[model samples]
Target: MNLLFLGDVVGRAGRDAVLAHLPELRRRLATDFVVVNGENAAGGFGITEKIARDFFDAGVDCITTGNHVWDQKELVGAIDRETRILRPLNFPEGTPGRGAAVFQAPRGRRVLVANVMGRLFMDPLDDPFAAVGHVLRQVRLGAGAGAGNGVDAVIVDVHAEATSEKMAMGHFCDGRASLVVGTHSHVPTADLQILPGGTAYQSDAGMCGDYDSVIGMKKEVSIARFVRKLPTERMTPAENEATVCGVFVRTDDRTGLGVRAEPVRIGGRLAPHLPEA
Candidate 1:
């Protein structure tokens, strides 16, 4: 099955880019499932119910979030009701909304989607590795515990700031997951490769927002803070055209392992990478 994982969506531009192209992109790539990180989708801080609905309407299978998942106060209640949306699993216990779930693919396939946040340089929540390992144990590839015949694939989105932590998670889930990719840094890394264990791994998947600014924020304000060594005006997302960026991976049906994976960037300032028709 072909699965697409999109990085953080910054603002209106990011949402527009996905709505305009994701449907067609899914068709061209023959994607069976798609996961989009939407923590920053609402004005660069937290996702709202309306925005989450927009993504679901746009063919996104599930939405994952990180540290900013609670930026929108109203989202707390909405996320609880929406099974398609997810917050970081390592968030404190009793947190609203789920961090992992098993979803159905169009082709009668069961797919597991899990999201976790890293601690190094991030909020110290539950141990990500432990949380993820626990989830991994709840189900296994080709052998679902009464959920179905078996899980056809697993997608793990590691929202993290440090590359080392992200890489560690990838190695930790090497043979157990179909794809392990990182988000939160908003810069796409070029080290897309199928690991020796058959899992697709990428350090960072980049953002689905304007790349012309400082990681999708207004450049001038971001630069001022760095130069002045003090807080400036509140950061807002860049409004220019956004480039939807992420990774595309195809996994084997029998082994539930990744066979091909690569970075995907379209529109805006960056050079594009799309599957050939």
Candidate 2:
């Protein structure tokens, strides 16, 4: 099974790039499932239902989010209806939407995708490791395990600011998940490898937006805030062409572990790369 996980989508540029290239990517990569982080899709804040629907129409199977998941107040109520959109699993009980869900893929295969937020330097939510472990225990991965019983693959999105926290989560789910990738930093890391336990791990998948600016925001505004040590204009997404960043993992059907992993960067300022199908 081939799984593609895209990093945080910034504003218009990022969204447009994904919509334009995703269809071709699906064909070229022969992807069975695709998950994109849409937290920052709405003017660099939260995702709107319309935007989420746009992604789905563009062939995205699922959408994951991070700290900015609730930036759009309407999502607090609408998320419950859209099972494909996932927020952090560590959110307190009674949280509007789910943190994890099992989605059906081609050939009657099941794929479990979980979105969890790291507490370090993030919101004080439930323990992400424990939250993820609970779900993994409930849904074991294997082939021919009966309907709603076992999944063919597992993908975890660890949205965090600290690289250490993200790396810890990858190691924690080493053998259990097919791929564990990080988001929120907006800068793609060079380390992309399969762990000893068979899971594909990347410290950060980076943002699917223009890299010429400061983490997708306008360079001048971001620099002013940091240099002056005072509040400036609100940060907005860069309007230039965006580079879609993500990770692609091909998992073994029998064991549900990753057999190959590669980083994906297309368009905008970053060099382009697409894994061989």
Candidate 3:
């Protein structure tokens, strides 16, 4: 299955960009499944129900969250009702939404989607390594231990603050998961490769927000906050230009191995790298 995974959607700018460009992208890429990080979809904080639904309507198969998952109180209840949205598996038990889910993609194939957050430089949470291991075992067992059992692929979203942590996680899940991509650090990393064990890996998928400013934040506001160290008001989305940044991976159905992985950057100031026809 061909899968597209978008990075953090910062605010209005990011959402607008995705809505405007994703349709064409999906068609051109022939993506069978799409996952977008919506943690900051609502004004660079947390995703709201409306925003999450908008992403769903715009061709995203599942929505993933990171440290900002609960910034908006309404999401706690809204997400529980929807299995398409996923929070980190390592979140303390009793957290409102689910950490993972299995959804049928195109061709009636099952794809297991799991989200886990790295603990290093992040909020205190359960061990991601353990959480992910448990989920992988369940999928493997359910698939009849390599029978493939109508299970086409497994995707892992490692939302992390550090590149080292993300890379480590990718290596840890190399052969067990089909694709292990990272998010949360708005800046995209240069590396995008299929590991020796066949899992696709990217240190960071970048942000699906305004590219003209600093990490999707208004330039002046962020500058002021950091330079002065004063409690300045939060930054808002830029109204004009925006971009969508992410990683796209194609995995084999029978073997659940990644065939191709590439970084995608669109609109705003970034140069276009359209998918090959």
Judged by lDDT, which candidate is best? 2
lDDT of 1 by residue, 59-119 (tens): 9999999999999999888888899999998888888998999998886788899999999
The local distance difference test score of model 1 is 0.92
C-alpha-based local distance difference test score of model 2: 0.94
Per-residue CA lDDT of model 3 for 204-259, tens digit only, reads: 88888888788888888889988999998867866567778988888776677788
Candidate 2, position 183, lDDT: 94
Q: Give the TM-score of candidate 2.
A: 0.98
Candidate 3: misplaced stretches above 4 Å? 141-150
The TM-score values for the models, in the order shown, are 0.97, 0.98, 0.95
Output the better candidate (2/3) by TM-score: 2
Error of 2 at 62 (Å): 0.5
RMSD of each: 1.4, 0.9, 2.0
Error of 3 at 149 (Å): 5.9
Q: How accurate locally, in lDDT, is each candidate?
A: 0.92, 0.94, 0.86
Q: What does the lDDT read for residue 190 in candidate 3?
A: 86
RMSD of 1: 1.4
